[model samples]
Target: MNILKKVILIDDDQINNFVCESIIKNERFAEEVQSFEWAENALDYLKNTAVQQPEAFPDLIFLDINMPGMDGWSFIEEYKQIPEEVTKNCCLFMLSSAVDRKDIISAKSLKEVKDFFSKPLSPEILSFIKEEFICS
Candidate 1:
C-alpha cells in the first residue's frame, strides 16, 4: 500500500523530475506523482486544487532551490499566503543541486521546509521520508 496519496515535484530540471518520479513510483511511495517545471505553475496548481479539490492536494512536495524565475525561497513566500487548511498537511522539502552551506542553512531555517536534500532523489531517501514524515 502506498504511504502517501500524492506527491508533487517542482524543479526546473526535467531530468531530475523524471528521475525523482521514477524513484517515487518504483518505491510505491505514493499513489500519484505530479511534476512541474516551473514553481509558479506548481503554486498555481496548489492554489487551484486547494480551492477546487482539497482532497487532491499533495501530501508531499519536493521543491528545487534554484530556478530561472520564482526560486524556491520566493515560492515559499507566496505559498505562505495560501490558507493553512490547504497547506497544513502538506510536507515541503528542498531538493536541490546547490551544495552551498548557506543554502542548506537557509532551508533549515524555514519552518515550512521539512528538510533539505541534495539532487537526485533516491529510493532509500524516499523510504526514509515515508517513515519519518508520512508514517509518523
Candidate 2:
C-alpha cells in the first residue's frame, strides 16, 4: 500500500514535468516517476507500446488538463482502452491549474479521479501519502 512507490506523469508542458520530476526525485516520494511530454506516448505506453510487462503500474498519476492533441479529457476517455486490471491499480489525481468550477465538478464526479489539486505538487502531499498508505 505504499502510495507513491511508483508514479507516472502525463503532461505536455516541459516546465511542469521538469518541476514535478525534480520534486519527486529530490524528495524521494516515489521509487521512480516516468514522465511523458506527450499524452499519446503515455497512452500508447499504457496500452502496449512501451513496457512489455507493464512494470510501470503507477500507484498514482499526475495528469494535466491542457495538452496539444490528447488533452486530459481525451486521455481519460481513451484510458478505457486499458484493461481493467491496470486501470484498477492506478489512482488518478487531476493535477492541473484549471480553476473552472465546471472542471472541478467534472473531476470530482469522475470515478477514476481520486482527487483534484492545483499545480505545484508539494512534498507535504507526498508525505501524507507515505504516512497514509506506505507506513500504514
Candidate topping lDDT: 1
lDDT, residue 126, model 1: 89
In candidate 1, which residue pairs clash?
none
**Candidate 2 TM-score, C-alpha based:** 0.86
Least accurate 10 contiguous residues by lDDT in model 1: 127-136
Relative to the true structure, how large is the alpha-carbon lDDT of every model? 0.92, 0.80
lDDT per residue for candidate 2 within 1-136, as digits (tens), equals: 3236678898888888888988888887777788998889888877882246665667788899888988999999888777777678777888888899899899879888877878888888677656754566
Listed in order, each prediction's TM-score against the native is: 0.97, 0.86
RMSD after CA superposition, every candidate: 0.8, 2.6
| Model 1 C-alpha lDDT per residue in residues 43-129, reported as the tens digit of each score | 999999989998888999999999988999999999998888889999999999999999999999999999999988998788888
Q: Model 1: residues >4 Å from true position, as ranges?
A: none
Deviation in Å, model 1, residue 86 alpha carbon: 1.4
